[model samples]
Target: MRESSSSFPPHNNTSNAIHKFWNTIKCCSSSSTSASFLFISLFICTLFFTQWSHYIYFPHSTSTTNSLQFSNWTTLSNNNISHDYPKKDGYVLNCSSSKALTITCPPNYPPSNRNHKNFPSNQTCPDYFRWIHEDLKPWKKEGITREMVESLKEKAHFRLVIVNGTAYVKEYMKAYQTRDVFTYWGVLQVLKLYPGALPDLDLVFQCHDKPSIMKKQYRGWRAFVFGSRDPPPQFHYCGGDSTFDIVFPDWSFWGWPEVNVKPWVPLEKDLAEGNTMKNWTSREPFAFWKGNLRNGPRPKLAKCNSVNKWNAQIIDQDWIKESREGFKDSDLSKQCVHRYKIYMEGNAWSVSEKYILACDSMSLLIDPKYYDFFTRSLVPMKHYWPVNTMRLCKSINFAINWGNNNTKKAQEIGKEGSKYIFEQIKIENVYDYMFHVLNEYAKLLKYKPTIPEGAVELCSDRFACSPMGLETTYKIETMVNGPSEQGPCELPPSYEPLTLKSIHDQNAKIKEQVLAWEKENYGWSWWTWW
Candidate 1:
């Protein structure tokens, strides 16, 4: 009972020595081991145990066991399923009861980029391409002619010509020159670039507008048709009665005087009161002529929330703001919309001719270039203040009477006219109306004589047909003859001669006045080779 308890404690020198030795050995080992080495050993052991535990717990997880496999798991719930337990790439075992479950990820398992599902940019033409092609092609084809073809030949020494002038004034000669026989002359009138003219002839096509003309000089000729349709008092029919093959006037007699007249508003009067003609006139004739004599002054930049003095204060602030905002970027779509609402001009011999030809329901004002510039799908409002009422009655279907000296009468007429226009004309239906008008114009073209007389019988059919026939004529003239011709000469019998003499008599007196005026003012005498 009293025997020594070995299991109990016994303080012995031998055991103490052994413990001290072991402690010293442990301290030495710890002191020799580096912190990084200790950390690495712990990390390796932890990783090994963690992997072993994961593999034991999740035996079905191939991704956990195989380092190569990686995946993303998405959980989906159904009415009967409380949790989805379908196996996936990195799925871990879980205990759950559910009637249905689905597990899915991208087919490749690891996605290359975050936004791979987005649609790519389109590199094809827009839906409107077909329509655009249809509309522009036919018109473009009308200008190809024999003269144009001959102009292509390098040794021919002939270049294709395009005379930008009043169609009525320049048509007779243009038609004559673009025929098959005149292939050597290589003349065609219209606004277009000839492929052959490049790098050599450098021929530039002509445009009626001054702005366009200034950019590139016309190849053949430049003439201005003068006189108005408003017979007597305002404008005398001079060229209408002339015998010359071509008779053109200066700036004075083209459109209604109101188009040139300053605004009647008090503010305009005040602005002009101290300004002299010399001060206001531009040094560039083209600019001055265009703004004052051709298309009215460029539409004042639409001011936001401000009054527009030029438009008679009729334009609403909202409208101005909208228009200005729309055109801020100068994009074609936006600019075209603004352009459609404004008036444009082309070349014309007389103010009356400009008005008659320029009147359009979609255009904001009338100008000589309306037909060419406005195109279709636009409505025109005319500047018809100074024009003769009788001529107005016969010519224009849509007009804006800016009022005569009698503002009240003008306002009344404008009100009635505007109402009629709003009811009868719409932007959508403009082309239909234009085609109808063209048909009517064609009838007049048929009855016209082949001679230059007055505005009534000048055989202006040439002008109307020239747009299409001119091209055909040029092609026949230039290309048909091939490159065999030795020299350029006038076309034979390409155009019919204008011969009605009665119409010419009416403007004889006016012609005398114009000739006298030219002599006195410019010190130039009237000369005609024909």
Candidate 2:
């Protein structure tokens, strides 16, 4: 199970962390090991003075912005607005029957239906979006019915309905920490970014880290399934081929305030700048991995935290201590000083994958069972060097040695990986993925989507920019500035059966090549170290 960030201090006071950063730099200088510290300290100091205030912790979040511009999403009142769905686990909102929540918004916000941009005729979406069709393919023969969606009510944490491009949401249960809240905020931002693209649709979205639906459950279900229905198409944060749920980008894209990690837009820009301050040749040579090693392959990774044994530096994260320290040591921008960084799963696919790849360091990606929205498109050698599961330390050790020996090749891989992330998965692509995934899912709905009786309509300004919680603070920092200057890229068509098979085969062959190289270079069972 994914661990909760509850141990963290509710508020992240990073805006006032200059003193802590001083202590961190002093400690680094005293340690006197890697010159990478020199670069990081200088880089941190520069960003601290210039970019820090824009991201300063806003205790009363609404104080930061003065403009109150908003889209045309006034809730349409109905006599039945206050009623609830009689169903056991389900409730939702219809776009037409909007009942706005009583949250405060800046009274003078501007109208949304202005300055809308058009999609460029030359642009195409990244390859990962093709899976939207694959994910909904099970219901292709028999289009998804309302009964299948209603049956999932028991497992859903919340229900979301989008009608005429406005969002209405109903909460059934609380997800771990603020997953449900931020996930909802993320969806709202998508609507704000692309005002009227998402079609009318209803979905039962669960925020849990794992997939609840299994294909075997609805193995032989007829299109007419209601009670004890087949594992219907469910939307969740993540999944693997082993499970049948649809995967979207996890909530960290907006921000993970519990960990004091900023949202992707600012964090991505900051990390990109940090990557520029130091070159590959001027970094710490050992492969680095740090996090809460409480589950999955992380604890075993701790064994490789030795210079001579694994040529890797693995640090166990103490979240409580970091939180108490005002998250000085937990800054994502400060951690990219190493030449090679490791990506390992913690019970599931880690959100750190994007941060790691963005560092322009040779990313040593270990085998993972689950994948998020973009990891599937990652080419083994081009984006990252695949680390094997067996003899874990030995594998990591060999990767570090090989990278150090082949600096240019390793650096190119790092650049390509970083380029893919920055160029392909920009904030626009993220919104596009959300747009197409929901748009395709809406195509499969056999019944007209409706606003659940008790649903609350959400707009980015009122719901996301509320100026109250930590989630809101992060949202304020990263919310869309205006309607996107361009429309979403045109998504590529689905892969043919053989084409999909070839892609998988090609990836598998690349991994096999790495394993084969290890065997050829180092004889079997060569335990020469004392």
Candidate 3:
């Protein structure tokens, strides 16, 4: 998930932008008379045109909105629109209503994975599906209010409102590396796959890497805030310690092309088939890892790269080199030719963990501190061989040796891990996860959803137009072909208090057993975790 790259240059705010335009105008004009005329004309045109601005950007918040007004980019709110904002050919624009392009669902489209047989009345969803309930738990009792949402107006990146099956986003700031853009596209894809499933609701989404709505911070400690804001519904990619930030699926699920990874739809098959290409015994007998060594405890893991000693093959990933090769080397499916693959958190909970688990390699996952949407369901011994964070070299060694001694169990573990990821987290299941999350969250909204003041209606046509023009092809490829024949696999009932505690206790017990085995082989070392 951590990739090094040069950023596309930054654009200036209103005044500086207009000043830059004036400079260009003066440079183009032959005389002052022509320059004055051109300046007037350009300024008038700027007022009329609406340009959709997006890319990786930073520090755009409520504090900056008043000062950093759009000069080249128009503020896309409901109050100012008369007709569709037009731009140059090949570009798509969002309208209050789509007069130019009306999207009709199930457009005589190709066949999809609509279950023909009558699904059982008690068909239960996977365990990970239960996380949706926990994610929305904060808003369960009181329900989400307009005030609670507006509180995050200055804090969050975008306000997403889905009304009458149409989605719209009021962007407060730009997200890192088109994370916001692709995430919105993922949500839209969900709506397409499971039509009428996601209900109308206004939810504020925090686009930054870390969660912001801390429990202590929101408990009315600040004097300016109205009253106790116990918990505000702030949806984000990953969760933090004791935070109310709802964890949805990360953007990498769609694709991480910047790092040369394809979307999950194709990548799933690629990795699954890659498993068949090389059996576990046939694969290179080493604990393989190729990624940035700078995040979390990965730098320490790099030291364990002695193939003869630790049976570890670690690569200090060169993101630049991979990008240069058109990401040919970074295709994840090709990298599964090793018996054991390593997973380490990069910055926070990484998107790579899922891909690693799906590789059909015995995943030697270093005890993870942060988790994405699906990881909670993963049982330690069943899904992965837990490696100790404190003793990286010895721990990894023990795991490889243990697996080598117990080939049958190791192979079963590998297959089970991949089966969970490949079969369970397929494209259909991914959409189902999103649908249940959004649908349950919408049920918690106390107030009727409405289009926020500055939102542009986001449909497939409007969203496909990329300013960077990097992900257009990928987006088209990842889109759901048509509506599904069946509704989502039935979501199981929420776990009882004792049942949830038992599951947590079971995971801890498994980890403890692994550590005990490590201690018996090698002396227990003090944990200096990163």
Ranking by TM-score: 3, 2, 1
TM-score, per-candidate, Cα-based: 0.20, 0.77, 0.78
Clash-forming residue pairs, model 3: 77-454
Q: Rate the local accuracy (lDDT) of all candidates.
A: 0.23, 0.72, 0.71
Worst 10 residues of 3 by lDDT: 72-81
Among the numbered candidates, top TM-score falls to 3
lDDT of 3: 0.71
The count of backbone overlaps in candidate 3 is 1
Per-structure clash totals for the candidates: 34, 8, 1
Q: What tens-digit string does per-residue lDDT give for candidate 2 at 196-290?
A: 66678999988876677866555555424544544677798788887789887778888776667777877888899889778889999889988
Strongest candidate by lDDT: 2
Candidates in order: C-alpha RMSD to true structure: 33.6, 15.7, 8.5
lDDT of each residue in 1-530, candidate 1, tens digit only:
01111121222433554566456556554555587568756765554433322211000112212122211211111112122122233211122211112122223311121221132223332221122222222223243233333332332221222211111111111111112112111121111101121111111122112211110121223222322111110001112111111111112111111112111122122222322222211211110011222123223222211222222112212322433354233211111111112222323322222222221112233322222211221222222222112222111111222221234443343333333333323221222222222222222221222212211111111111221222222222212111111211111221112322332343344334533433453344344200
Model 3: per-residue lDDT, tens digit, 286-367?
A: 8999888987667898899999999999998886676555666666888889889999887777788888998888999897
**Reference-based lDDT, residue 332, model 3:** 82
